[model samples]
Target: MKIDVEHVTKIYKDTKALDDVSFTLSEPKIYGLLGRNGAGKTTFMEILSGHILASDGEVLIDGENPFDNQRLTESICLIKEGDNFKKDLKIKNVLRIYAYFYPTWDQELADELIREYNLNPNAKVKALSKGMASALGIIVGLASKAPITIFDEPYIGLDAAARKTFYDILLEEYQAEQRTIIFSTHLIDEVSLMFEEVLILQDGKLVMQQQADALRDNAYAVSGATKDVETFIEDKEVIQSKQLAGMMTAYVYGNMEQAKSAGLTAEGIPIQELMIYLTENKGA
Candidate 1:
């Protein structure tokens, strides 16, 4: 399931949610769609999921347009943030409906997750707690077994333990059943390791897309005497810099070997911190 987004754009009155965004994602890998709030992450997901049409350009799934294409839509499952079901439906009923719609849905997996999460299948969706609701959504998303599974901040209200469970289960499922997973979330550090590739969006534009390991290797925190640190990054892209007392730490984006030769102590920067620096300061 290869997704090719070409020159896609979305306009909402005065706001340009997506500005000519483009990317190509090959199948059977986890992709992290990362960005700050209102950076077009959600918009991109919506377009790909066939929930919204792009104002310009196109989005294709294996060379076919996905918007309103039932065949394509059936193969792509998007777990958005917040409630997506009718309030009156019971938890079990919701899963049953989804199972009917998605031909590839695994009932056995769904049953296992239902038991693991301890969800009351008889309980109405409106009566469930936030965490329980999120768990249910995750179960549906994973059990659907769509070729392209997208989770947009799926653990919004989950606790640490519950989130860990979700991550573990997701990975296990992925290994057992190869699929394309696009995870968009602000919890970058928590899920960074699971991503094979990362796509970064900034202010409605696609800024960077690279292998997760390569991106992490390129991002580093270099610190030394203020003068030496500044000199070390003279011509490089410095994402962030701060002075604590007389010492300064600069987060520079480039090859680590370049900084090592300059005698600067380079430390790995957390993906979350890197995202903040890139999106907050316009890749400063």
Candidate 2:
């Protein structure tokens, strides 16, 4: 499904959660929705999933609105960070309920995941540990087989090993059947490799949206003598720079080859670092 966000905006009292953000997700690829705290990542996901209405503009999935639209809602599954189910519901009941909501729900897969995660279906949501609850959410998200699967910080309280297990299963599921997956997480370094495209929000604004590989290929950290580095980056788009002890390193969005040819030591910037540089308060 093609997701089209056209000038979408959201407001909460005096704060603008989203400010005229526009982007087109035209392919079924894994997208990393990245931003720091309160950067409107959650707000954007809510608007996209129809949990909340946009204050202005619109979000269209295959040319139709998602809000209160049953057909689209069935095709969209959003697994949030926490509190995904009612406290009174048992694990089995939660799965059963979601199975009814999502026509494409796979009971077999859900069962397998529950066992794999070592979750007891008889346990109530209130009794499960934070990690266990997150595991339940992951199972629902993967088994839903929704055309658009949005996971917002879905693995809270999970240990590194458990998180890896979820990531492995997620990749396997995506490979088995391609669908749009929008993953929002704070552990950027851990999941950055899975992102085909990255969209970054900064202070309620769309700061960067680009192909992950292209971003890695073009963005570089060039280091050399302060004067030489300064001269080389003068005409380039510098995301950030630091000078120390006569040496300067400029995080630049430009040709790596050109930087290398200019006698500067250039290295590709990791997506996580790139995001930090792009979103940091440069004026400071």
Candidate 3:
């Protein structure tokens, strides 16, 4: 279930969604695909799931190309943003149809999830509330039991409680099934602990890919007097900085020891906040 993206690129008319991005993923691990809006995270997932073709280069699953390949498609389920289910179909009917299509579909899991989420199977897809619709999508994705499950913002309309439930259920299923999960999300802090590795995209390009813990350790936020912060960061790679009321906080992308020596209080920055800072000050 390893995924390999080599020099992959995608262009839409006047815009380039992906710019020769490349990465490799081993199976049986949770990966966090992180980025700001319009960072090509969605485009990368779409190419991997065979929903869209890469404008250049290749996307492969276990050495085989996944584009339009039925065998590979059946083993990879992608729950993308927005409602993709047929509006005319009932929730029960949709589940039934999916069960028939995927040989590895788990009926028991689907049934349990439906009840746990308090969803009415008889309700038409279009009739369900936004939260319920997202819940249904989650059920289908997990029950499909696809070896490679890619979830792109699957908790869009879910409340905080419901979203926590989804994460808990996902962890339970992954531990029991040992499947590869690629989660693309903006709620980085909520799900950061679950990710073994992280892939960060910036403006259609791969900015960084590394072990989650290692990446966090490599970067930090240092705060002190405005002048002190400036002097401290003079020789370092300051990813971002903010000053207010004579105090300054700067995100320095380097070793903590260096920051401490410069008389700055270096603290770990949460993944979500770090991403926002990075994407916002990408040019700085």
Candidate 4:
């Protein structure tokens, strides 16, 4: 499924949720939607999911608008943060309801996941804990088998072990059925490995959209004697740097295939650290 967002902008009474944001998702792969708090991530997700409209520009899912369109919306499953299920509905009934709406829903997978996540089918939706609720939402999302599945911080209440289980299950599901997955979360270091592409938003604008591998390939940290480190990074775009006494460390982005500076220690920058630097030093 190809989802094209063109010059999208959203404005509130005095706040601009998004400012001329644009991107194209032409393939079925995992994309990490990253940014700091209130970086227009949720706003953009709402627009793409058809829960809200862009004040300007358009979002096209398979060359068609998804706003209130059952055909397009059915192909997309958005598992929002926190619990939003009916208190009266049992866990089993909730899955049944989801099955009714999602045409590609898999009952077998749902049942299996419910057991795997230790969620009781007879328990009421409101009776479950926050972590259980998140687990149920995750189960629904993975079981939906929608062409486009979005999980907007769906693991807020989950612990490290449970989160790991979710990630493993999600990767397995995606491998079985290659579908577009847009995942947004602040736990970048933990899940960055699952992303094929990373999109960073800042203050209502899309700051960067790059492949995960490309970002790592281009980003590196060099440390050595101040003179050597500076000389080695002189021709590169340094995102962040620091020095103490005679030692200097520079975070750079560029081709370093032939960079053979003696006494310099070069290391690949982690995605999470790079993201923090990018957001902290905007427009640098």
Q: lDDT of model 3 at residue 193?
A: 94
Which pairs of residues clash in candidate 2, taking residues 3 or more apart in a chain or in different chains? Answer: none
Off by over 4 Å in 1: 243-246, 282-284
The TM-scores of all predictions, comma-separated, are 0.95, 0.98, 0.92, 0.95
- What TM-score would candidate 2 get against the native? 0.98
Instruction: Write model 1 residue lDDT over 1-284, tens digit each, in one string.
Output: 88899999999999999999888997689999999899999999999999999999999989999887999999989998887788899998999999998999999999999998899999999998888889999999999999999999998789999999999999999999889999999888899999999888998998788888987788999988999998888898888788887899999889888777888799888787777777875433
Per-residue error for 160 in candidate 2, Å, reads 0.9
Candidate-wise lDDT, in order: 0.90, 0.94, 0.89, 0.89
lDDT-superior candidate, 2 or 3: 2
User: Which 10-residue span in candidate 1 carries the lowest summed lDDT?
Assistant: 275-284
Could you tell which candidate, 1 or 4, scores higher by lDDT? 1
Superposed by TM-score, candidate 2 places the C-alpha of residue 2 at a distance from the truth, in angstroms, of: 0.8
Over the full model, what C-alpha lDDT does candidate 4 score relative to the true structure? 0.89
lDDT of 2 by residue, 83-170 (tens): 9899999999999999999999999999999999999999999999999999999999999999999999999889999999999999
Q: How high a TM-score does candidate 3 get?
A: 0.92
